[model samples]
Target chain A: MTTPLISAAERQRIRSGAHSGPTAGLAPGHVQANLAILPADWAGDFLRFCQANPKACPVLAVSEVGDQALPTLGRGIDIRTDVPRYRVYRDGVLTEEPTDIAALWRDDFVSFLIGCSFSFEEALLADGVPVRHIALDRNVPMYETGIACVPAGRFSGNMVVSMRPMTPRDAIRAIQITSRFPSVHGAPVHFGDPAAIGIRDIAAPEHGEAVPIEPGEVPVFWACGVTPQVAIRNARPPIAIAHSPGAMLITDLLNTQLSVL
Target chain B: MTTPLISAAERQRIRSGAHSGPTAGLAPGHVQANLAILPADWAGDFLRFCQANPKACPVLAVSEVGDQALPTLGRGIDIRTDVPRYRVYRDGVLTEEPTDIAALWRDDFVSFLIGCSFSFEEALLADGVPVRHIALDRNVPMYETGIACVPAGRFSGNMVVSMRPMTPRDAIRAIQITSRFPSVHGAPVHFGDPAAIGIRDIAAPEHGEAVPIEPGEVPVFWACGVTPQVAIRNARPPIAIAHSPGAMLITDLLNTQLSVL
Candidate 1:
């Protein structure tokens, strides 16, 4: 197995335009965050939404308006160039997928570094809890749940959850392990029957590739980082930018630093 | 509703033979322990069994041989009298149910105060997670599982688990809440499927009354204090003592003090 790059080195590679790919497994112990850059006009509402629905949108760090650097998350980090790729959305529609957002940078832009599942997934793996999606080499299954996010100002949308199949034994351990990292969605929101949460079909996921659930395993669901993206889509801001799916903002903060306990 | 007494006052009543019924809901915030007194020769192995199976038998306090007071648990607490009632067993068969064991106490006896679910259950209720059995005024259903405890010396037996049915939402919260109190069985051992853990029937439990598991609810199982009791029976010690069902030993220690966090 190849050794993973350090968070700063990986961010440096991405900043230099030498690496343009998914950030998964890039930095072994560092936190990789979901990116959401919105206009200053919409940032406050988005912040309120995150505050109201913390499990789904745990805000790790927020950049000052017109600032490109997230000093708290990492040293010398540039929001414009550090992410491997960025998706520019215009009026809630995807306008372009760009390697860098320098050309489209606006003075009113505010960056949000939301806690991603990568942190808690790392915690789960460290505790010997089997994260099925990682083992199967597949994208974690995600579905649009009937549970609605507590609306804040203009943002309103249903929650989107990521699922991992685990036996009840493993699920219990996973819950204890993940509860320590409240910033990374904390413990699971639901498990067992899918219909109970208004997900009609377990095999057919609305967002990511479906993974097989063994006979004795229950599909444990955690609030996904994608929930914020869905809310952004519904809010329909004039201009918004986010890291391309899987191309997260690698931060200097270690996953262990997020543990509330 | 009847006002509950303080821990010390409740224990005083029990010791005075004025309170011989169940100890549940008597001293609300205090930690109530399951009692196990055995001959000094058999105590070492029983302690090992508890250490090996902490999730099922978390030892809160163990007494010195011939000592009746658990000073660490409560002030002026006598194990022989603090408990509401005690069960005397000879050669694995229960022989008597006494209000106090002071008359039966031997100089070679060693008292063990094992954590009971009451501590975590109080936490769960405080956190607004409904404990089904408690709400229904019935005993929490318990079953014998095929999962065997690690044997230490003469003690060996399959684990016994107590079941509490909950919706997936409540189960997730309950797991997080209970995990904080590791001495009180910690988090649940298994959930979702009963057969997965060798439980033949959900409705028919080996011990305690069965409560309804409404639609959308799954049965969550926690490693029970009774696990050591089963081991005690299998060990067939010449003389053994345990707290009568629901008649726990009231401790001065607050339930919140048990939280590892």
Candidate 2:
């Protein structure tokens, strides 16, 4: 049986156990976030990374050192187990993707929840602009660009961009809609010539499946959360963890509430 | 001789004599608008036309039957001769380009002042966004798009778009800035490939001179005020009048006051 859409409290309860899975279509209209955890020793650098590269890592909430609770982000959020799923990293390499992070918890671990494009995509869809990849039931196409992010501490890498094919009219409206939600990717970074930003091929996305573009449409690009993942790998932190792609943390905050105006 | 920038009263004094000339760079910081005077019998259709295409024809003020004064837009404003130049048309064909229209004033005339992109372009330049056309001292590149506007009554045509080349980063920021001034053309209608909208060549514009596109820059397109002129021609009104291109009516209203937020 398909699981019914549940309330935030109930969803958190499900996530507290072994029910970790993709948070898509769950808690509709509520904001979903990407999780990034690091040891306190590396927290300062990672925090700098998020601040310097806000489009890819819009920091929604951060917990103090040795703290597992993030009261500001949700109602009694247990950072160690609240995420639907998590990736565990050891010596800068992903070692495991687990449903529950209780076993991997450390006293010095700090948690950060970042704003995700899922929120702005929902906003765009609500405003009647069709999101291509979502209509085709595929992941949005993402690629690594030659354009470099600002280096902060030990975190820096070429930016990762997500692409959506749209007619020029819809693309303009999408830019207006997404710009209001600056915490999530904001307006598109580039359009038309993908190679101008260093992507060699339009059909060969480095991170996600490519969707078909019509003859009269252009591929609009936005900064992607994967940029931070690349930076994390480059930084080579002793220990780090992040939510697996598409497996985000469904939060109590409503997406509408994230709009600055 | 360069005339001194003057107030509403001073401009009115000069206009009272039916003085006609180009109104470029007049009354600095004050808003200038394009005029469309249609018979009262055809006013509703033209209103619908403007509503169907707000970006091209943002209605700033409309005068009542037999009233030539545009009080809302400026003090003691007379639609008959306030503008520096005018183009009078009959059966959709240009019949006269007069500076003063006191002799052609009619009781059935209903005047409209639509927002012009000049106001927002000034704002952009002031904000340090490089406006290529202005820098090159030429008209902005404009194209006839294959995209049809929402038809209203007898007024319908493909939209006209103006182009400027900008880097991806500035385009993102420009999107945010222009969104605040909806009274103007608002946000860009398109960007990137000109051919997507049936523009065969970016280097050859239908109206205005083409500006160079830097290696990493993309052409950003905004719905142009010329769009309404195209629609007006399609409507083929028995009698019509508009401000000559770049020869708008200087008004007392400040451009900054037009920001909705």
Candidate 3:
């Protein structure tokens, strides 16, 4: 096999505060994760929320209360400093965006690492299936769908889906490819008519910039990683922290290892 | 495993000239094939056509010239009389629909047994995926699409696809399931807009009865076994024979054995 363009060296650079930005397109072939840190008092509800809405928030690993290390995901990985950036939320409001959360780490803080879409997108591109937004160098279009996620305790909200435009033939292959990696939002939640899932305007997305849908192409939607952020906002815990958009926690795990087939 | 609804006894009954009609629901777990027999002179072009249009004419077995048996498909299976009904065409024109072809059998005749959609439909129904036409007790609707099959020698024509109405979620699961059985048409070629593939009237199919598409359901189209028949007519072979519509050759091979994964 060919050598990956990036390696674990990038994670070391990020750990040493040399890199502080979105981790997208960095450390190719590695599993990058969406991070969520919460107080132990609220961890139970958050874990239950992930279990209920698995497609949206497939939990990869959970740290012990007050522990900053995630040994299972990577070698000597420190959750407080390994990620490029973090967003601090206080009572559901954005409070701070920090590079290192060591100063603010609480004794009862628990870290949750959830799977991201990069893994399956890698698989799609490897199979020669075009990912429209990625080709155009734009964030994947995200929309709030009418389909409701199963609620757990205080976490109750509709699902958020990320969209990619593809021809019907490519979409079928994409479904088969993505189904093997259930940890990163398995098979698509919907395809074709956006209105069927309650998204009225194709040009206007709720979160990311809208990408062009070429002739003979239909927008395919997958459950988004942003769903947990929406659930967290609904829950309104006393304190919570998550990775900044696209600034993920790079892990030692290889993305291809996640394929069940 | 529990006993199949129809046993190998049905094939015995058909061989003994006791049964002569459509074999649709006769053998539950076994494979049923669409048969195409042609003169040795035309066999090469037909085989190439099947190889070119695999999704439409997936070849399950091919008999040697002058052979009347298909040993690989079943024990003591004689292709000449095993099928309940046969349609004989002379110079591209339908001449006779006969119960047995013993009188018309030629030493230079070659038989091609192609996969049928019944195998994958059984898999889909077994996995709890609703097949609309089956629920309504109607033939699966088939349409001629603008998508042309790759021309092989004298055989060149547009593809014929069968339609099944399913919700996007169910369609995703069905794609995953059907992909396992590539010999039986594999995954859907297209879904949603029928006009994208050049079918103008969704209600009026060229063959089979049209089943209703319920609200929130889209028509998923798979390459149809009828495609080879159309190709044969276009080729205008001096002599050709095929099984009558829905009157298939039952094989002892289990449908489950066709799954690649």
Strongest candidate by TM-score: 3
Residue A29 CA displacement from its true place in model 2, Å: 1.7
Docking class of 2: medium
Whole-model Cα lDDT per candidate?
A: 0.89, 0.81, 0.89
Residue by residue across A1-261, what tens digits does model 2's lDDT show? Answer: 212244456556656574676666667787888788999988998899889888878899999988988777667667777777778777778889887788878899988888888889998898899999889888778899998999999888999999999887788788888988988778888877788889999999987789999987878999987777788888888888898777787777788888977
| Model 3 agreement with the true structure over A44-110: per-residue lDDT tens digits | 9889999999999999999999988888888778888889989888888888999999999999999
Q: Against the hidden true structure, what lDDT does model 3 obtain?
A: 0.89
**Deviation from native of the Cα of residue A153 in model 2, angstroms:** 2.0
Which of the predicted structures, 1 or 3, would earn the higher TM-score when compared with the native?
A: 3
**Candidate 1 error regions (>4 Å):** A1-5, B1-5
Q: How many steric overlaps does candidate 1 have?
A: 0
Please give each candidate's TM-score. Answer: 0.94, 0.90, 0.95
Interface root mean square deviation of every model, in Å?
0.7, 1.9, 1.0
Mind giving the per-residue lDDT tens digits that candidate 1 earns over A62-111? 99999999899988899999999898888888889999999999999999
Q: How does residue A178 of candidate 3 score in lDDT? A: 96
Regions of model 2 farther than 4 Å from truth: A1-20, B1-24, B198-206
Alpha-carbon deviation at B56 in model 1, angstroms: 1.6
RMSD of 3: 2.1
